[model samples]
Target: MASREFLKILSSARLGDVLAQQKLAEAYLTGAYKTPIQPANALIWLEKSYFSVTNQELKDKQTSSNSTTEILTQIARIPLAQTFQSPAFGFGWTSFWQLAHTKAETQLHLAAKWQLANLLINPDHQEIQAQLMEFLKGKNISSSLEAIAGLDLKGLQKIAKQFLQELAETDSPFTSAAKELLIKLQPKNAALSSLWISWLDDKNEEALLQAAELGLTMARLTLGLRLAQLDGGDTKSNASLKKAAYWLELAAKDGDRDAWYALGEIYRRPQFSGYSAAESDRCFDRAADLGHAEAQLRKGANLWRKREKSDEKVRGLQASYWVWQAHQQGIAEAKELLGKILESCPDPQKNDWHELALQAEQAINHHVEHQLDEDWLLLCHRIVIANQFHFSKAELLLCEVGQLQHEHCVVVDIRWELPKILPRLIQIETIQQRRALLAAGKVFASSDLEIEGNLRQRRYRFDRVTHWLTTTFAKANKHQTNTELA
Candidate 1:
């Protein structure tokens, strides 16, 4: 909700007040009054203020308008892999280019040109790929980009390439990014490079920086690691860590798990100016999600250590799930830790989880072997929910999925089954896990009254479905073994 004060400012802005317009734009740009940061909306009022001041209206407000416009321009100057989700994306390039071009009477032109050129050539992101069709049709073409092209595709790319080359020749924050994009755009250079990635580890600063600028992940990663090293705990040595973070963040954004892990370590260094345990955990989690075996084991171990939290047993189960993922990736430490954890925790039957998943898919249908396949489908949903959220069997069977959702966790209350049992809170973890829960919740949402009757009837249904699934799995398991042997 827009605050009453902000609403007054908005009303005044709509009534042709230039100061109100500028204030409203600033508020939108900076998310003032709990407003969502909407760059497109900011640009609208800003453009109004810009031309208004240019027309000799409110001359005193000129400098502040210019400063705000430049800030918006910088925000528009994002990376080559940006997902274009806003009209502000179009306006950013346009506004940023004009601002930078005008400011380019000095050194700031390089930043503006870097953004315009890269955005023209290098946005091969999957999200942008869909819009290539629109680009082909010339539908949604911005005039600034069209003007920069100087000709068709060939001249457009050539102009962009020239801008990148010019930017790289100068030293600035965008220099490395410009060079990396140029290297990526030119396959010939990538093909001609004969230097082994291993050689980067022992390379000098100049050699490493040059190669890293040329989009070699190994060189950039090595350079970042070298810079991130402690310099005898000198608090004044923050410059090195900042530079390291810049290079590492680029690699991490490009989906390098190793870079993500390294970044996590860098964030955790006590001597670093920006040391943050929470940021370190987020980086490690990203690495873990990207299938880093060591990260998975560490994440699992960390979760297990915190098992004495709210739902201790459920926490242990959740921790085991991460360890299980690590085990599949062939981590020896994960296997050892998993063995020890399983020794203390009660797990389900030793059937392959993948195999059980397949069986669930097979059994959740009209069955030739039994008339209880319908209930078995609901049973599969229950099993998936229990395994995902680490709910108890009774909670899985009795808790209403719709009713149990809290902000960050699921409230599993089976006091309906056993009056003495208290409600337990289980935190939602991954998006995949959340999706699985939502899917199961949807099934139970549409269920008939018979499917979710009294507690005694529900338990009886659960028992029948379990028997059916067990019997079916046994037959299929034996048949598969016999076929493999024969």
Candidate 2:
């Protein structure tokens, strides 16, 4: 039986209100406000609460310069930002900064999980013991034990692991913390020890199978690839490949590029009875997207081969983009193919390339709008990205933040704003270009569209901002021309 106010809070929770959800979860867990004690229902709301909190944090950070600096710092640290990671790492590191804010109550949600992870790894950790005691005492004072359990022991570990895993994937201090806890959480079994030895020698089939079953992604990948490469004439080859595909598919879902490439190879093996070119190509495409260099070359060649006659320019642009990526990674074959590609695919620039966005951003120093109006601030960010991407005025004004992004390009289609204007795909060529795109996309995704207005209204707003930018650039150019003439 629920009270009217309790049902109202539940309604708000269902509508994605994090604070409301947290409140309901607390009330349910502790039997607060005469609500029935139900740890399972509490876990349900708590999960929703954390996820919603994350979404809200992102939305809030969209307008913060602190967030921008943090994001840029993270992106600039990636090992292969230029070729392998155009925009993929851009999205990942941007998501790294999670909910660590001034709100003490909301933070307890994460703190509790962090302590639980610590305690899971070291059951006698005195610091964690103190922290957990403080947490349970602070939040409604009882039945926090049931809240952790979600009414079962396995459920508690799953929740803790999931929480830590999400933290580990990001580029925050929590990432290392989450990773350390997760590593220790793995069972200290004979199978795991055997799997460690197999990494170097790889002869122990029984050891590999046990570790793969225990959910080690690298073990699955190693075993699957080893199985995939077995002689096709073996009587068990078909079954081995089938089993290889199964394990490789699981590893691929975990974002292992090697697993994706192996799956591609297995599917394309001519001797395999269940061979499917379409499926093989799909796997290769995914592998290429994940930054496997050889897969990029294969994907590029495949695209070149299947290019549509009518849409040659578009298809060729797309193909050459992948081929160009492979060429950059010292692929000799890709370099030869790129020579052919360049004949059909003209260079993307008419003028020598300049990072004018970086210069313009420095000149304007427009981040101040963060203190003024968040919408205006994001508009400034979008303008910087548009300049970086070499967007035309119309494209800059009309492009949807999220829709235009591709692996190698941003699709700028503004026919909805001006039917006479055609759409185009602009290449994302630099780490800086990817950085700009991530910045704009991060902000604009959370902006209020109705407040931003219709296309015509947006155009007027763009024109207003465009005036100052043009004036500044024109002045700079005129000065340069005079200096050159002298």
Give the candidate number with the greatest lDDT.
1
TM-score per prediction, in order, is: 0.60, 0.39
Model 1 per-residue lDDT tens digits across residues 1-486: 889989999999888777788788778767888877776677667666555556765556877567565544434434423425554345454555564546333445666677667666775544554563355345354444545433455555576678888877888877878876776776635433544333545545666676676667777777787777633444335677788888888778768998898889888877678999999999999999999888888898988888777365344666766786888899988877776554321233332233444455466543455554455567777766665666666777787777655444566777766878876655554675677667777877777636566778777877776666668786887899999999
Q: Which ten residues in a row have the lowest lDDT in candidate 2?
A: 78-87
lDDT scores of the candidates, listed in order: 0.67, 0.62
What lDDT score goes with residue 58 in model 2?
A: 61
lDDT score, candidate 2, position 134 = 40
Q: 381-454 in candidate 2: lDDT tens per residue?
A: 66676666666666666777777677766666677768787656565667776776786777777776566677
TM-score for candidate 2, residues paired by index: 0.39
